[model samples]
Target: MRLRNYLLTSIILLTSLPVLAQYGSQKKADNLFNKFSFVSAAQVYHNLIEKDFNADYATRQLADSYAFMRNPDSAVVYYKKVVEQPNVPIAYYYNYAQALRGVKAYKESRVWLKRYKKAGGEINDEKFLKDSDFINSIFNAKQQYFLTDVNFNSKYSDFGAYEHDGHIYFASSRNTGVSTKHIYGWNEEPFLDIYVTDKSVNDSIIDHKSKLKGDINTIYHEGPITITKDGKTIFFSRNNFSKNVLGKDEEGMTNLKIYKASLIEDEWTNIEELPFNSNDFSNGHPALNNDGTKLYFASNMPDGFGGTDIYYVDINNDGSFGKPQNLGNVVNTDKNERFPFINNEGVLFFSSDGHPGLGLLDIFGTVSDKDNNIISVLNLGVPVNSSKDDFSFFMNEDGLSGYFASNRNGGIGSDDIYAYDRIPQLKIEGTITDITTNTPVPNAMVTLLDSNNKEIARLETDDDGNYEINIDRDTDYIINIKKDNYIEDTRQVSSKGLENKVRSITADFNLNRIVKKVTPITELYPIYFDFNKFDIRRDGTVELDRIVNLMMNTYPSMIIKIESHTDSRGSSKYNDKLSLDRANATYKYLVDKGVDPNRITEYKGYGEQKLTNDCDDTMDCTEEQHQANRRTQFIVIKME
Candidate 1:
């Protein structure tokens, strides 16, 4: 009895050990995750899953952790399991959908997106669901930027490139001269610091880099800055560290804040934190308008639409700031929106994962009115974006060249700076020709119209029937060709895929010539006859109707004669009778179709005498040649 009791007690304790361990592990993982230590939390959750202890919860947490770390490829593996379980959270459906997109699984991502919507989850962008072709349009849009990595990138996180005073200012985690470095837990890299490098005349290269001269360099994170036009002041993002104390919110987390410094003589001094910053949330990635009248940055203070939202404040002439205002729902989504850049033309460029993109975060541009209301957002397609996080976009006043950063593959660092130049031009060129003789239809009026049928330009073809016109990229165009004695031709052409590398597109036009005077009906379609047959074929009647309509409607006073010929396969006497019967058959067809009998001036048969080729019974020829000889013609006799 004692031995049995001992074994039962041992079994109970052993069975309870795993549950206790799982409970403790779950608490630890949750704490790390809430602290924004996603990398550490993911490892703990992954271990719990491998042991099959609280497997469902562990899987969900693991998926969330990877998602927060922007490791979608790994997150998708765990999310696939979490979403399949019963009673899954509605938010997980959205997370899975976004994860699927990060791996370029767009079709599957849309499926979950619809499920998320059906589950009462609100999607801010209704157009994303209503426009079924939206995703396809993003993928099919023309490539506007050509990107190349800068030569000065390091093996650490190097990004946030900006230009001012002949120097390129940026943020990097490549800490130098620090005896001991404090590493950020999120990416396991050194904390970010502000750095500057001399800009080479050739934009592709850069001179040696050094830390910005100032007391601005702190032990905490700093950088991704914006400077005033006169170079008298600067605004940069840093951790909530001031004086000698590091500030933390009630949650024991350090948040980002914007700080301003003045350039005095040769050193930057008088550092002061922006007034609207909070210890409870993050506000960073600063940008300024062309005249330095507005300051824009991303923040998640409170009541934001997503993890982070873009906000801007007015800069008074006395160096004071107004209240921060959200950029509105049109530009903000249920995901992180960061790195706001305003060009000289008032176009805003930023990065977002919420919008439909190839994968991860994609850079998008929007034009705003004077009141700062966005009209529409456009994805900066192709080499400018990739299946990874892309942010910190900067455009020069010229708007033709710029710089951006991405953590995509084949880079020298966790993130790398890239230079981009817009494609110069796109053109459409083509030739116009007549259908009858395949001759050039020169001097033809060629009109170009936009997709809405609005005329854009009109010109005439050159002496060679060729015309060339410049066109905008990624647009649909209609080419209308018209010439005297030729039927009008319209063609729909798209310049979508041609923007990648091809500079020009060829769109030739062919116009059919209308019958005006004496001409053989065979010029349009040969009125063919079967061997030894006199009845009009179904095809032959179609050609006969054209003659009937021309005489009755188009040219009421026109007259024509029906003449038929036969091949050399039969005797001359037999061929003559067959040809005559065919001529009479055509004559009767026109009269039955309401053509005046007076219009048919004559009906005759030429028999084998008018053999078109050398197949006069003695010379063997192909069937096509023999068939050509057995044809009928409706020659115009007179026209008034």
Candidate 2:
């Protein structure tokens, strides 16, 4: 978990694995990697593997280097080679999963993440593993938003689109751009610059795009702009390479800085760097407060909480800037916290690789208290944020619809800008308990079915017998509850007929025991065994599962006696054996399905002694009537 010591560990690994002179290249790579210069380190490690020296270990490190370097495409390539290998480091599973996500391989990512959670020891974060399942659940949960790629997106990487009034401004690395043709080492993509395009009309997007005019679109990376409501002042992120005054960090790489400029005479003028801009660390992704009194941005500056922290600064009345304050650990983790976007309601939306998520960086939202401290953070869930690099979330003035960036699968570009709008929301919940005892039935299956009787959501009850699921606003739903040994229960709970508002209601399921007070309820569902076979049929198992639930959970104190009956068509001795075999097979099935074996007091064949209808050999009865005579029934004999 402590990555600062990785350099020492890598150095020791290199020296012990091979002769110093033979693996000097690896040592150099280790040193570079220790300094967090992952791009160059990945190259060295890659070359070492190509030369057939330490290929196994280099494969893992190389993948990690690419991952730390923010080059998911390359990381995915190398990580796949070492992810399933034995004796590999545990962290590789997590990194491999994230790399897969960065490439929008969510299912594959989930497989590796499962491995990561299994391998978790000292690096265990239980919530992280739990949230992984939640990520999958979010797919079937209430979906209130839709996404589509805009037409102006480039084949390279086009994202971070924000709209002001009518026109939309964004960042792009289109090859057609002017000035610098430099390609960034990370991801091997062209440098980014600010670009402007008209907002899509009626969901119709166009390819009309051009670089933002003036010195703002410099040789270095730029864009992710936010404008004041007045449209007079604008803040944008750019590398400190403009005007030949490049500011590099300790790694000799240029750091990003926030710049402010004014719109005057039909052009951006008074371009000045923000006072908080530093050469030692990167700062970018500026978001202005609704009233322009505060500025929120991401930075890796000194004394910061993480790789990047969302910080806000005050704008004094005299136009002076206030001290930058960290948004704190609740929102900023040791991993990354980037792309801070504050909505009209003062809720902060940011992208984070630090929080519990599907994979890679996920969009998260948090609201601040009066002191600017984070109160709570929620993963934007799914669709709004996929299992990839979903960041740069922006909300239009409408607050219900907006745009964001995602490198998820099916994107036309490495990263594409997508427009989205909120769907509707409905919350449904209930409790599952026993009808006889009125006791909570923990871990009971609570399934939500649509009007068509198709299962839409399946959840389990907690210790308190509580379960919840989200649905669309105003929809009819059937809630089904099932637990071992208990009779299945189904209840109808409708969000329909409700007005435009959130609704929460409890729909408790009281399950009765299949064997109730010395009576065998053959009225529930009939179970019949085929001739010469004792195996439980599909329909039999369905009926038996409830019996198993009733005996094991709902009425553990009741002793059950299962009697198997047969039609008169079979011989007396043969019928007796056949019926007994049927009873025993059913008995084994209940036990195998988690019912207590001791709960079954007696199980025997009645042969033709107990017929439900006139299906004897001498009688003219239909096959259906004969089948009804051959049935399995359970009776409650005694209570413990």
Candidate 3:
């Protein structure tokens, strides 16, 4: 029997050709690929993928080869195919989104990224954000900003701009030197170096661009540079180096480091590398405040929040560096963050792929109030950001117009510098109040729902019953005000076609109280009659339903009185007659909907005699004010 079992195992192992190759060729391909031997690895992965189309390992590696090869068009083709397969890995959804964005398919990229976020556990095939909080996060999208590419962008990669003394300093790969022969394996663009352009005008016109006069532009990639207010001190990023020779890691690749250069007789001299830089990991994208007391940069160093978190170090008065401090989880995520820029107003702007965004890296801003204690981070929405990689944001000293970088669609090169101006604010503000008491209703929840009743934004009324919603442009919104024990109110507002016009709207809610908890003698809510109409409308039925449910379930033998009233517009005889019909109608509706008629002992019509608010013939009142007088109430007369 043991011999037979062994024979069966041997047969099974021998016949599983696909499984064997999946275990064999995939490992070889991955090993070769990790060594950056993309040419050989692609060939091996290609053969394996051809045999089994659903082989995720082979398919992923092959696509990654093209992605790392800076061939997004080819990568997207494979990724699109991979995402279509059943039981695909969730991470592949994100990868496919990135590939789509790289090819400038911005709209398509968002669909895949949303799918990636939805690719949760197997038990639930619906949206991953079935919970309330997640649903709220993606309820609204920002599409107000206007982004236009600056003309200074070269045919090569030109990005990361800094403005000083009427000259703009930025990094580019325009291939101005013989070093252009050496291309980075990733992205295949020429090694980046800083360039200064002395142009004054703001439009797309470009002129007077040249390399930095100093030795700042090196053979390897040199990244974003930051200058202090005095303009005498500068900190820039470059490849890890010792004595001008590029330093390589164990894998024979270069990492980034921060170096400080001092202005000596108009020449940037005395270059000293900051101490905390590691040979294995990277630290790049230096940004400084006006005084240069602290330096912020992005790094993949050990024990960080995740991939490439932003870190800050204190630059002491004597030029010594302090220990690096991670910016915490609020500012960092499990993915990459790069290109941090701090403006003069103490606002910290950075880029990240981990935060909720359009698709890829979207620029985010963090700011603090005067005490430097209040911190808030906001996503700088499109067109300043896109479904593509947008990073390295820098605002001018004036804090108005500035520049950022993006590999987004319609750019002239691989990464282009884009000049942007802040868009105007559009908003809606309101208050919720009780009509009878004429008092503000604090803690009232105001929800702004779309046409489908999906809440885009919600807030509670403050202590003064005030609520504000920063509405989006060209969208119709339904504002719902709800509070416990009060009738819910809804109003529809259209924001469409209000883009060019500066319009902020005011909306107010006056809710009638619905107190259904009868105290064996307490008065219930008013059943309002509309302009001499004696019929119970849908609003009146809602109150009647609540009363019916309470009396039947909570107070079975309780006796009650239904009183209906009309406004002071009609004669007393006419109003009293109309009010009686309304009271009868309310009672009939309750009896029809399974409410015990015996529980309703008597029905009365008070007309306008028992007005809740001060609105009479002598008092000047609008239709809305007069609505308070026209109401219905149910009083519990006796208990079992």
- The top-ranked prediction according to TM-score is 1
**Segments in model 3 whose C-alpha atoms lie over 4 Å from true places:** 1-144, 176-180, 201-209, 367-376, 424-640
What digit string (tens of lDDT, one per residue) describes model 1 on residues 1-640? 0000000000000011112455467656654543334566678877877887656656777776665444568878988997897655566777777778777788998898899889987776555444443322322223446776577788888888998878888898886666778898898999888888878644433322377888787878998999988998999999999997899999899999999999998778999999999998999999998898999999997988988998999989898999999998878998989999988655678999987776888998763432545744667767888899988999876555779999999998899999887654345778787643457877898887777676655668878888766554556668788888778888887765543435467788877656565534333345999888888888888877876777788778776677899999978999999999988888888888898776676789989898888988679899899999999987764554
- Cα displacement (angstroms), candidate 3, residue 601, comes to 85
- Clashes per candidate, residues 3 or more apart or on different chains: 0, 7, 2
Worst 10 residues of 1 by lDDT: 5-14
Error of 2 at 9 (Å): 53
Runs in model 2 lying further than 4 Å from the true structure: 1-140, 177-180, 200-209, 368-373, 424-472, 475-640
lDDT of each: 0.75, 0.71, 0.70
* Candidate scoring better on TM-score of 1 and 2: 1
Residue-wise lDDT of candidate 2 within 477-533, one digit each (tens)? 677888887888876666545533233445667776664444344333558977666
Model 3 scores a TM of 0.45
Model 1 TM-score? 0.48
Error of 3 at 19 (Å): 82
lDDT sort, best first = 1, 2, 3
lDDT of 1 at 152: 75
| Every candidate's CA RMSD | 22.8, 21.0, 21.8
Clashing pairs in 3: 526-632, 527-632
| Candidate 2, lDDT over the whole model | 0.71
Model 3, span 247-300: residue lDDT tens: 888999789999888888877777788999888999999999667899999999
